[model samples]
Target: METSERIAQRLRQFGELEATTSPLYRRLAPLAAARPELVALLRERRSGQPPANVLLAALQRRLMARPEAPLRGYFATLGGTRAPDDELATAFDAFWPGELDALAGLVRTRRVATNEVRRAAVLRLAYVAVARRLVERERPPTAHLVEIGASAGLLLAWDRFAYRYGSAGFGDPDAPVTLTTTWRGTVPPDPHAPFTVAERLGVDVEPVDLDDPEAAAWLRALIWPEHVERAAAFDAAGAVVRRLGVTVRAADALTFLPGGLDALPGGLPAVVVHAFTVNQFSDAMRRAFDQALGEAARTRPIYRVGLEWAPGGARLELTTYPGGRTTLLARADPHGAWVEPLEDEPATTSR
Candidate 1:
C-alpha cells in the first residue's frame, strides 16, 4: 500500500499537469490530497491503476447515480453550470462521506480504461502513412487492424468516423462521429490516401460489454467532468460500434498476439495498434510482448502503431517488422487533442 504522503504528492502532481485541461480536477485534486479521508480512499486502488483517476472516477460515478445531488451541479458532464471554485472543495468533502462504501467499491473494482474515441485521429493518420508506404513497396493497402486493450472497440471503427485535422478532412463525410484535432509540425500523409480496414479485432483481459448499462456507465464516469465534448463523442461512437457489432475478445496480450497474428487472412499484412495500453504491462510482460511480435514477424510482415507515454511525453510510434524499423511519427496528446509530427529521420533497430 502507498503512503498518504506519497498519494498526496501524486494528487498534487496530477492537479498541476491537468491545470490547463481540466480546471475542476486541477482545483479539487490538491484539496482532496489535503484531506486524509480522500487520500485513504485512493489508497485502495488496484495495482496498475492511477490513484487520482480512480478517486475522481469514483466521485463522478456517485454523482452520475444521484442526478439530483448538489454535487452534480459542479460537474459539466452532469449538466453542472458552476465553474471550479474554492466552494467546490467544500462540496466534494460533503459529497464523498455519504457515498463512502459505493466509492470504495468503485475504486477497488474499476480500472482507468478510458476508450477515448478521439484517438482515432492519431490512428487514422498513422494508418494512412503505413498504407502509403506499403503501396510504395508493392504491398497491398488493405490490412487487418488488431487493437490491444481495446475497450468497447470504439477505435476499431476509426474508418467509420469523419476527421478534421486543421483544414484537412478525412473519412466518411456522412459519418455519425466526427473528431477534430489540432495538427502541428511537418505535413502528415495525404488524407485522401487509400487504406482499407479488412477487419477489426480487439484483445483485452476483461472486455467491456457496452450492452450492459452498468459497464457503459463506468466508462462514462471515467471521462473528466470538464470534457462534455468527450462524453458526447463517446456516446456517438458507442452507437456506431453497436450498430456495426464490433467484437473484443477477452484475452491477455502476450497469450493472444502470436495466434492472433497467425490467424489473420493470408496475403494482407497485420496492422497491430495500441494506445495507452502497454504502460499497464509489467517489465517482463512488455519484453515478452515484444518477443512475441518479433517471433510473429519472422513468418510475415507486421506493422505496429503505438500511442504511448515515454519519459518525456506521449509519442506516436510506427514499428515495422521483418527489418524492425521504428519511426518516431509524432508527439501526441494522451487524449488525442493534438499531434506534433517529428521532423527527424526514422530510427532503425534490430529485432
Candidate 2:
C-alpha cells in the first residue's frame, strides 16, 4: 500500500479508539487504575491478549494532541459548569506514555470495537440525527417538542441556542454553547421557521434540573467526548429548556405516553419525537412500545422518527404517520450524512 494510504488507515484506526470524555475518564479512573497491571497477568493467565494496552493507547493519543489551554478554556468559559475535571486531566497525562503506547499498538493492529460499544455508538448517533430532523418539512407552528429521557429534562428546550451545522448552521455560533454540525449532504430543517414552542415535558426516572448549576455541569461532563456536538447541543438545549423550561415527571414511556393525551388536550399540534431510546427495551419491550405509541398517535397527527444502532454503525429512520398507519419516511446517517428514502415526502396516515 502507498505510504499516504497506510498513514490514513492508521489515523482512521486511531480515531476509532475510544477516548475518555471528562466525565467518562472520571468514572473509569478507578477501574483503569485498578486493572493497570492486570494486562500482562491476564495475557499470561488467559488464552488471549488483554485490554490494558488498548486503554493506555487511548489515554496517550488523547493527551499527546491535547490542547491543554483550549480544553481548559473551553471548560472554564464556554463548556458550562460540567466541562471536565482538572484532576482527571492530570491523571490521564501521568498515565499516558506507558498505557497509550500499548493501547495505540492495539488500536492500529487489533482495532475492533466490541459489539456492545459499537451498538451503543450507532444507536446514539442515529438518535442524534433524528433529533436534528425534528424541524424537517416545516418547523411546527409551535416548536414545543415532547422528549422521552427527560433526565433533568435539560435538553427539552434546545431551540433557543446557536447551532453550527457547517454550511447549514442554526442558532448563534457566538453563544456560550453551540452544537456544531458538519453538513454531509442536505441539511435538516431550520430553527427560524414558523415554529414557536409552548412547552417541553420530559419523563425520566431522575431528571436533571437546570436551576442547579452542579447538576447541569455533571450532565455536560457525562456527555461522550467524541461526540462534541452532543455537549454543544445540550448547552443550547438546556438554555432553551430554561426559557421554555420543562414539565418533567418520573414516568415510564409505555404507561405515560398514552396517558399523556390528557396533558396535551385538543391533541398536541406539534411534531412529537423519540430518539435513541427504543433500544433501552428488549425486543418485546420495543414491540410493546410501538404498539402503545401507535395507539396513542391515533389521537393526533404524530410524526414518529426512530434511530436504532442495531449491530452496525447507525441507522436514522423516520416514520411519520398522520394518524394510525405509518411508513418509514427516510433513513439517514447521523447529522444528515446520507439519507436513505423508502418513500418520497413523509408518509402521512390519518384516522
Candidate 3:
C-alpha cells in the first residue's frame, strides 16, 4: 500500500477514537482531512509506523508548553477555557502547516522522544467498581498489587484519588480530584466497601519520574489537547505518587512476574493487574507470563485482574488461581468514562 493510504488508515482509527472519546480531536479531524499536505508530511515522518498520531502528539506537547507558540492561543486551558468552534477550526487551518514544518525539524533534531500515555488509573477505577466482590470472594484483608506496564506508576496511587460513577463512590473522601464515569447496564459491587493495599509495585522497561520536566511533558503530550479534565486528574495522581513514593522497577513484565510474586508477603492475597499492556507482549512472552503466574499460584493465594479489549469492547476479567477460574466483570469505554456491569459471570479463554 502507498504511504498516505497506510497513514490515513491509522488516522481513521484515531479519528473514530477521538470522535467517541475526545472533543478536541474530533474538531481537529476535519482540519487533518482538509490538508493532504500535512497528511503527506506526517506519513513521511511516520514511515511505516502504525501510530501516526505520535508526530501530532509531540507537536501538541511542544506547542502547549511553549507560551509564545501560535497554537498556544487556541488551547482552551492555556489562555481561556472556551473558544468558538469555528474560530478554533480557522486557527487550526492557518497554524497547522507551519507547526508541521516545525514538527519536521523537531523530528529530525531528536528534540522529542516517543511515549504512550498510560492512564491505568482509569482501569484501576474499573477494577475498584467490582473490587468488593473480588475481596469478598477471596476473603483477604490485605491486597498486594503488582502491575505490568505501570508507566509512571500513577495508577498505583489510585486509592488517593476519589471516584464517583452515577451515585456510587470510592476512594479517599478528601482527595483533590474526583473521577466520574457514567454507569451503564447492571450496578457494580458496593464502592463504599472497605479494601486495603498492603503493598504495590510496578514493572516497566522505563519508568517515568514526574519530577523530570521532559518526561512529564511527554506524558502531558500523550493527553489529547481538549481533555483538560484528564490532564488535571493526571497532575493530581502524580502528586499523590510523588508524596507516597511509589516504586516502579525497570524490568520486563515476563521476567519480573515470577520473582515479584515469590517475594510478596505470605498470607495476603496477591493481586496482579495490568491494563492495555499484555497485547504488546510477544506471544511467547505472554505464554511465559501465564506459565510464571500459574507456577506462583502453587505457592500462595493469587488473583489476576485484567482490563483488556475484546471483540466487543473493553472488558474486565478476573482469574483465580489454583483451579484457574476466570470471570468477566464489566465492559467499559476505552478511557473508562463509562462502565457496563455484567450481571452474570462469563468465562473467557483469554485474559
Candidate 4:
C-alpha cells in the first residue's frame, strides 16, 4: 500500500482508539487533526530501497518534533510495540544499512507514530484496574502496594492523590480526579483512609538510569503525548526511581524476572505486590515469568498479581501458587481507569 494511505489509516485508527469519551480522548482528536501535513510529509519521504537512516528520518519527522536543536551530543532510544511491520522491518534493515544507533537516533525524533501503540496502554490500564480490585478485595483495615512499572510510580502512589468515591471523600479533599476516573459498578474502595505505597520498584529493559541526562530525556519522551500532569508525574517518579535506584534487576524482563521471583525478600506484613502495566511482552515471556513466580511462591506466599487484559474487559487476578487457582478479582471499565471489586464472594475463597 502507498505510504500515505498506510499513514492515514494508522492515524484514523489512533483517533478512534485513543478517545475514551473522557477528556483525554476528546482533546487528542483535534491535536491529531491539526497535524494533517504529518501524513504527506512522512509519505513523500518513503523509499523503495536502501540508505535506512535517510528514509526513516524523513518519515520519522512526520511523527516527531524535537523541542530544540543542537542534538550534537544527545542519545536516542527506539521503543515501540514489538509488533513492527514485517515490510517496514525489511526496509529498515536495508536502509540504515548497519548503523543501528544512528538509525535509532533518526527514529527517535519525537513522532506521533508511537501514539498509535495501543496495546501497551491497554496493558497499563489493565494493571491499574486490577490494583484497585486487589485493594478492595483484600481490604485490610489499611493497605499499601509496591509496584514495578512506576515510570513515575507517582501513579503507583495513587492513594496520595485526591479522588471521589460515591459521596464520601477518598482523595486528599484538596485534590480531585481532574483526569476523570469514571466507573460503572459498585464503587471502588475510597482513598486516604490509610493507604500508602511504602515503595515502588520499577524495572525497564533500558531503565532510564534516572541519573543519566540522556536516559531522562528518553523517559520524558515516553510520557504520553499531551498529558502534562502525566508528564510531570513521570518526571517526579523518574527522580524517585533514580534516587532510590530500585532493586532494579537489570536485564530484559525475561532474563531478570525468573531470578527476581526467587529473590523476593522475606518478611513483610500486609503487603500486596503487583506490576502496573508491563504485560505487553510476548506470550512466551509471560508464561516463563508466571511459571517462575509459581515455583517461587510454593514456599513464599507473595500474591502473583496481574491487572491485565482479557477480551471484553480488564481483570485483576491473584495467584499465590501454580496449583493455587487464579480468581477474577474484578471486571473493570475498559477505559474508565479503575477496578472495583466484585466481592460478593468472600476474600478467603483464595486465601
Candidate 5:
C-alpha cells in the first residue's frame, strides 16, 4: 500500500473503532479528516513501518497520568464524569498545530508502541463460556492455563474478575472489578459452572510490568481518553495483578508456546488461551504454531480457546488436542461486552 493510503487506513480504522467504543474519539474524528498533515506526520514519522497509531502511541502518552507531562491535569479533568462534549471538542479544536506537532515529534523519536491493552480481563466472559462447555465435555479436574501475547499477564488473572451477563454471574462475588454485558443470542452459559486453574503462565514479545510505574502508565495510556471506565478497569486489574504477584515472561509466542505446552505435566487438562493475539503472526508463523500444538496434543490433551476477528464477527473458538478438532462456540464483541453463543453447536471443526 502507498504511504498515504496506509495513513488513511489507520485513521479510518481508529475512527471506526472510536465510533463504537468512544464518544470522545468520535467527536475528534473531524480533526483527523480535516488535517491531512496529521496523516502525513504519522506516515513520514515511521518511514518503513505500519502507520503509527498516533492517538494511542503519541497523544495519549503525553496525556497519560504521568508526573512529567503538563497536560496530565487536563487529562484528569476530561477523564472524569463531568467531561462534556463541548469541552472535549474545544480541547481538540484548540490543540491544532502546536500540540499536534509535539505529538508528531514523539511519534518520530519516542518509540511509542501500539496498545497492548491486555484487555483479557473482560475476555473472562468468553473464558466462562468455554469453561462451561469444557465441564460438560470432559470436566477436567484441573486446568493448567497458558496465555500467548499475554501482556502484563492480566488476562491470566481472569479468574479474579467478577462478571455478570444477564442473570448469570461468575468469579469472585466480592471481586473488585465487575464486567457486565447483556446477552446477545442463545441462553447465556452457566456462569456457576465449576472449573479449576492449577497454574497460570503467560508470554509476550515485550511484556509490561505492572509493578513498574512507567510501564503501568503506558498500559493506562493505551485506553482511549473517552473510555474512562476502561482506564479505571486497567488500574483495578493492575492492582489485582500486583496483589496476586502475577508475572509474564518476555518471549515471542512462536518460540514460547511449544515449550510452554511441552512442559505441562501429563494427565492434567491443559488449555491455551489467546485473545486478539495470534492474528498478529504471519501466515507461516501461525501455521508453525498450529503444527506445534498438534505435536503436543499427541502427548496430552490441550484445549485452545481463542477470540479472534472473522469476516462476520469476533469469534470464540475452541480446539482440542490429538485430532485438534475446533468448535465455533460463540461470536463476541472484541472487548467481551457481549457474547452470542451458537444456537446449534457445530461439529468438531478446524480452521
Candidate 6:
C-alpha cells in the first residue's frame, strides 16, 4: 500500500505532466490529490506501473462503461461537452464512489496498453531507413517484422496504413487509417523506398485481443479522454488488424525474442521493433534483452527500430546487430505527433 502523501505527490506530478496535453487529467489530478480516499485507489496497481495512470485509467473505465454517468460529460471521448473546470471534480466524486469495487478491480488487473496507431508514421520512416541499409548491403529489402510489447498488434499493420510526412505521402492511399506527422530537419529517405513485411508477429505478456469487446473497451479506455483523434485512429487500425488477422503472441519479450527470431525463415532479415515498451523493463531485464539480440545476431543480421524514452526525450532509433551499431534517427513525440531528424550518420557503437 502507498502512503497518502506519496499518492498525492504522484498525482500532482502526473497532473503537471498532463498540463499541456490532457486538460481533463490535468484538472482532475489536483482534485483527486486532495481526496485521500480517491488517491488511495492507486495502491492496487501492479509493480513498476505508474500509480496515477492506473488510477486514472480505472476511473475512465467506469465512465466508459456507464455512458449515462455524469462524469462522462468531462470526457471528450464519451461525447462530453463540458470543458475542464471546477465542476469536473464534482462529476468525478459523484460517479466514482458508486463503482469503487469495479474501479479497484480494474486498477489491480488492467495494464495501460495504449495501441497508438499514429506511431506507424515514425516506424515507417525507420523501416524505410532499414530497407535502404539492406539494399546497400545487397540484401533483400524484405523483413519478418517482430514487435516487442505490441499491445493489440495494431502497429504491425503499418504498411497497410497511409502516411503523410510534410508534403510527401506513402503507403496505400485508400488505407483505412492515414497518419500524418510534422517532419523536421533534412529530407527523409525515399518515401518510395522498397520494403516488404514478409511476416508480422508481436510478443507481449498481456496482448489485447481485438475480437473481445470487453478487452477492446479497456484498450480504448486507456486513451486520454480528450484524444478523440487517437481513439478514431485506434478504431481504424483495429479494423485493419482484424481484417488482416495480425498475430500478437502472448509471451515475455526477453524470453521469446531469440526463438521468435530463429523461427523466421532464413534469408529474409528480421526487423525487431518496440515503442514506449522498454521503460517497463528493469536494469537486469534490459541487459537480458541485449543478450537475446546479441545471441540472435550470431546466425543472421538483426535490426531493431525503437521509439523509446531517452535522456533528452523519446528517441526514434534504429540499431543493427552483429555490429551493434545504432543510428539516432529522430526525436519524436511518444505518440508520433512530430519528428525531428538527427541528420547524423549511423553510429559505429550503441548510443
* Candidate number with the higher TM-score (1 or 3): 1
lDDT of candidate 2?
A: 0.46
- Indicate the residue-level lDDT of 268 in model 3: 72
Candidate 5, poorest ten consecutive residues by summed lDDT? 110-119
lDDT of 4 by residue, 1-351 (tens): 455556555545555664342233233333333444444443443243212222233333323343232221121222222222334334332333333344345443422211111122222333343345446657432322444443433334344344433443443455322234444456544332343334345444533355656445544554343344554445544454445455433456556554554444444222234443445657776677667656655644444556555666666665545354566656554432544555433243443
lDDT of 3 by residue, 1-351 (tens): 366665565666666664554566656654565567766766445333434356556567667656765556656545535443667766666666666666665443322222222334345543553456555676655678888878888767776777777776776778876778777856554444434688899888777777888677767776666667777777777777889898989998877877778787887767788877787678988788777888888887667777776766687777767566677767877677777777445456544
Model 6 per-residue lDDT at 241: 97
What tens-digit string does per-residue lDDT give for candidate 1 at 1-351?
789899999999999985567888888888878988888888888987888888988889889888877778889988899987668867877788889899889988898888999998877768877888789889879888899999899999888899988887877889999999998856754655747888789998889989988889899999998899899999999999899889899999988978778887777788889899998789998878877888888767788888988766588888887667788877878888887777535564444
Question: How many clashes show up in model 5?
Answer: 0
Among residues 3 or more apart in sequence or in different chains, the pairs in candidate 3 whose N, CA or C atoms overlap within 3 Å are none
Winning model by TM-score: 6
What is the lDDT, from 0 to 100, of the residue 71 in candidate 1?
A: 74
Q: Residue-wise lDDT of candidate 5 within 1-351, one digit each (tens)?
A: 356656766667666764565554554554565567777677646544434344444666655534444333345423444343446545654554666766776666533333323345335544555566566777654678888877777777777877777887777889987767667766656544435678778878888787878667656665666666666667777788789887688888877766677776767767788878888778999888888887777766777888887766687777777677777777776766667777435445755
Superposition error at 94 for model 5 (Å): 5.6
lDDT of 6 by residue, 42-132 (tens): 7767776777777877788788779888789888887888887767777878887788889878877887668889888888778888888
Better of 1 and 4 by TM-score: 1
TM-score, model 4 to reference:
0.54
C-alpha RMSD by candidate, in order: 2.5, 11.2, 4.2, 10.5, 4.1, 2.1
Which model is ahead, 2 or 5, in terms of lDDT?
A: 5
TM-score of 5: 0.80
lDDT of 6 at 98: 86
Misplaced by over 4 Å in model 6 are 348-351
Q: How does candidate 6 score on lDDT?
A: 0.84
Whole-model Cα lDDT of every candidate shown, in order: 0.84, 0.46, 0.66, 0.41, 0.65, 0.84
